[model samples]
Target: MYRTARKVAVMGAAGAIGSNVVQDLLSCGVASRIAMYDPYEPGLKGAAEEILHCAYPDADVSWTTDAAEALTDASYVISSGGAPRKEGMTREDLLLGNCEIARQLGRDIRAHAPNAEFVIIVFNPADITGLVTLVHSGLSPSCVTTLAALDSTRLRAALAQHFDLLPDAVTGCATFGGHGEKMAVFKDGIEVAGVPLAEILAGRAVNGRTMSPDEWNAIKDRVRNGGAAIIKLRGRSSFQSPAHQSVAMLKARIECSAYPWPCGAYFADGPYAHVMMAAPVTFSTLGMTAAVPDGDDEDVAALQDSYRHLCSLRDEVIRAGLLPPVADWTSLNPNL
Candidate 1:
């Protein structure tokens, strides 16, 4: 794949997720300069040194404890902040602390890299935190996004396995709404072997087996609970998949890839108004455009539920004093 030269910054570079993101950025050879920031000097130095050993091509990498130094002149900012989710902990459990972290980090980005074109929030409770960042960073809704693609990728993987096909063969699969358990996984949007999943569910056999509605429903359940399952098996929240997807998002944004990823983007006036949630979005030089999936009535209802949940979370942030009221949003970021 071809890549362009740009100044990229990674927040929390010393953490597990951030280190993996740094490694992927280097290996992809996209940015001309990769700047890493973390308060922990020793871990940051170690992570940078580790990447030095790999000697990936076409990029210069540096580490810093100072946020401004790392972010100044950055073209893109990929940030993973807050603590990782452990077993039995829902994303809501990590909300308040992560909100504060996101608020301060967002202010830092505003103070330092106000001109940066895009930002990706990859921490726990990203839908909420991404909004916090967007508000405080004073960036337009289109300029900042979050890692909703992970849930869609999980959908892709689940469909691939159920159909006995390679992951790449599971095309057009997407989820919309929150990236958490309430996300809407649209079976109608999925395709395997170039055939719509709804067709397969309607007695069109694939791999010599027609899927029953029960099986399709089970797959949807799996997609919704994918993150929790990962923690139960891996003993930590995901890292490798998140790293790959976030970098792929970077590649898509910079290259303007035609494929629209399911991402956590702000919806201002549509059904998901004033909420940052997942939808099918393609990035380009002009900014981002979202096309919410026209799912079935049930799926649409699910999306609405997800939206209400996210709105509640946003209100919680407001009540906690992490942000101003919705009426004041335009004052902080006029583009919103």
Candidate 2:
């Protein structure tokens, strides 16, 4: 039984990221049969038959209206379906709609694909949908993951350009916190081949842009607002970055190799899992098995700040009745 021949399902496969992900998986020989699941039975942009001819012609491809049917015998699920952030829209704007979509899909997965791993690739308010899916699916948080690595990777790109360093040289740096209005990227302890990030900042200048605390803060804020900036400029949310980040996440979940990533994850210490929105986590086959939040002093402080901001958002979501009651590791589960 070749693994690439195994079944994989993609909800909203015709949409932006989903379509490309299915293709990427096929290109990598990850799944044998690909099922494209979309809620809209009619008016779909791409037909499964046609999509296969275009993207994965040699493999078996199926399209269906039923999400459960797609999940059956599936080895992986890359759920890229959700309302994208549009111009003039806020995170809270698409919450209710995406919440319902995620909740329903969670229930379906729980019933049809219990124990199957999932990757949620929706935009801002992913944690909200994550909470809904957690409750509905009752899946261990380990089996369900969200796409926060994109922000972290973005931060890395910004720093790489700022310091005139190669993108691969950014071995350090992680973006943490909610992928909302309050995301945090930690660069304090950043080192390139053992050189401190601050040292690099002091010695290098890029396009006349020097790295200073003020400049760093400004750049970070711009990175946080990068999505909004794109939306405003493009009039609609762009798909390239989302699709790019999503594929990387799929690699993390399936390949489970040691990839250092700055992404959102449920940090399990003793017996409870709290969201670690900002931290360098060594991702492997188990979907974020450990969280190494320990970093340089400034990095650690930034991490603390990131955790605080996440807690604040969690509190607000709970208070607003958007999320169920959440407890830290001690109050929740203690068997990790």
Candidate 3:
């Protein structure tokens, strides 16, 4: 039941992450044609050549400087283009520049690949950039999403290490809200070895060592600061994990499988209106639905804080002239 002759487009396909994304998409073996778009001619050509050398008969790989050429007829689009963050910068610091990039990319997608089933935003400040893209793309919020699961995955790793267990032993780790410092890491939402983290912190010892509340707080801090830690350790922003996770999201969308990871999706109505925030969710060709967490008041408050933080960022973008006010959003894209 494989779909035939599907075209998948990768924006910023020449960069470190984008190149890896290109290869990953090829490995998926779902797309009969893979279109790569990057303005950097040398990098784009080199990436295309390297993949061509592999000679995957299932993929008809093509690179282009033309946005329309790359995007036309694409079934799904993954964008990771924009300036990379440096050591001292927060995700919000990358906002102004990256949102402009996202705005233009969205316009191109609207013009050329309006029917693209899913458009994933992966550059820094993905929540804001994702909102920018969704507004300009003239597509419904359900058709667009952003990569925000890295924080949750980082939290999962921290929990596994704290419990001295294999990573898979930790489950139900969820991160909500923005993908930056303001994200909410819900301890009650996670389990180590199928036991609640809150219970473990209360008294239960795992492997003869109990985790105190302070220890749990430290783990949350580590998850929040994980990206900066990576940049300090590696002298560059992260690429591989983001690339892999975004591609996994696309694959899930195509196969209609449940996505265990959190995704940044639009909230048009409710407490989080006019912002994009990550939440537990399911995806399909039709759209996405963010799950209401079954946790306690603390979880609700933390998620609300993250939502407010994201709203501030979104408002900043609007005020800076990057986008019109929220009232005009529907005018820009009727689908919203």
Candidate 4:
């Protein structure tokens, strides 16, 4: 349990994921106070009311249209404020608008919550949003992380189902790179009931059937496209699962869990200079500490490719004037 009472702020508290996150936070009793901000005034008020009615009536909840008002003195800031991805839309399709949203929110958070321990990005093209937030907020890359845990969770569920094992038994599974289709799922260090997953899957028949290499590829592809599949079926993007993932991450951060799961798009320096891609990270009061060197060769290669893709996307955003130039960033933070 956390000893300190902290203020948690949600930037898009009216939206599907944001409202669900608010409920999760209150239900988990993680925050002493929660400030909810949404540009849509009515939606914000309604969401707050609904949350209050459902749980934690005594919880300190505030709703606002102003980012500064919500972010003031916040310990953790979650950015879920942006347009949802439509049925036929790709994550990149939502990039420009969401990046603009994140850019302004980052500026406000920097001004209002300069000392916030973590700024979590939950919007689409999460890697880019995280990068924009890191640069615009003028915070260390370590202070920001994108919600990649959803992908990891999806992978674990899919693998567990494939092998007829419980999800908890499938441990040490990790998803790296961007939060989109390019993200890589790593089986290294993964275990099932104290047995290595690779070993268990090797020439093993499950449910009177053996999973071929092509079937494994199909499973991974399904994991990568899980969000899109949900959107296609439901006519909107996911909400509850992502909200749950966000709360889990918040719990890990607040409790200082020793075995923090891998999250998407964490800011990297040293060997992963000028990049914010998915990797294994432990959250602390200072910010996220990544285990970049823990990846196997395949993971490293996929991560580098994802990094290159993110760089290209950043360049595109810079060209559109949505974000500052690389030179400006380097000038501001020479350490990066």
Total clashing pairs for each candidate:
0, 13, 0, 1
TM-score of 2: 0.82
For model 1, how does the per-residue alpha-carbon lDDT over 1-336 read when each residue is reduced to its tens digit? 327567889998998889999888767755657899998899999999998888776568899999889999998999995766566877566797898999998898899999888899998789999999999998887789998887788888887888788898888887888876778777666778888888988899877767889998888888888988998999877888888788888888888886556888887787788888888887778777777667889889888888898889899999998989999988988888
Order the numbered candidates by lDDT, best leading. 3, 1, 4, 2
Candidate 3 residue spans exceeding 4 A from truth:
1-4, 30-32, 86-93
- Model 4, poorest ten-residue lDDT window? 264-273
RMSD (Å) of each candidate, 1 decimal: 1.9, 3.7, 1.9, 2.4
RMSD (Cα, Å) of model 3 = 1.9
Question: lDDT, candidate 4, residue 207?
Answer: 45
Q: Kindly list the per-residue Cα lDDT of model 3 for residues 1-336, writing each as its tens digit.
A: 223368888999999889888887767655557788999999999999998998777678899998899999998899998777666887556788899998998899989999988889998788899999999999988889999889989999998888789999899988888876789887775778878888898899876768998998899899999998998999877888998898888878887889898898887787778888897778765777776554678887998888889889989999888899999999999988
Model 2: lDDT equals: 0.65
Which candidate, 2 or 3, has the higher lDDT? 3
Report lDDT (Cα) of residue 257, candidate 4: 80
Q: On a 0 to 100 scale, what is the lDDT of residue 323 in model 1?
A: 87
The C-alpha TM-scores of every prediction are: 0.95, 0.82, 0.95, 0.91
Top lDDT: which candidate number?
A: 3
Enumerate residue pairs that collide in model 1: none
Tens digit of per-residue lDDT, candidate 4, span 1-336: 323368899988999999998888877777658899999999999999997787564678889998898999998988888777666877566888788888887788779988888778888788888788877887776677888787778888887888787888778877877777677677778776666656655866644545667777888899889988898999888899888888778878777886446775445456556657778887676667887736678777876776677778888889988877777785544434
Model 1: CA > 4 A from native: 85-93
Residue 291 error, candidate 4, Å: 1.5
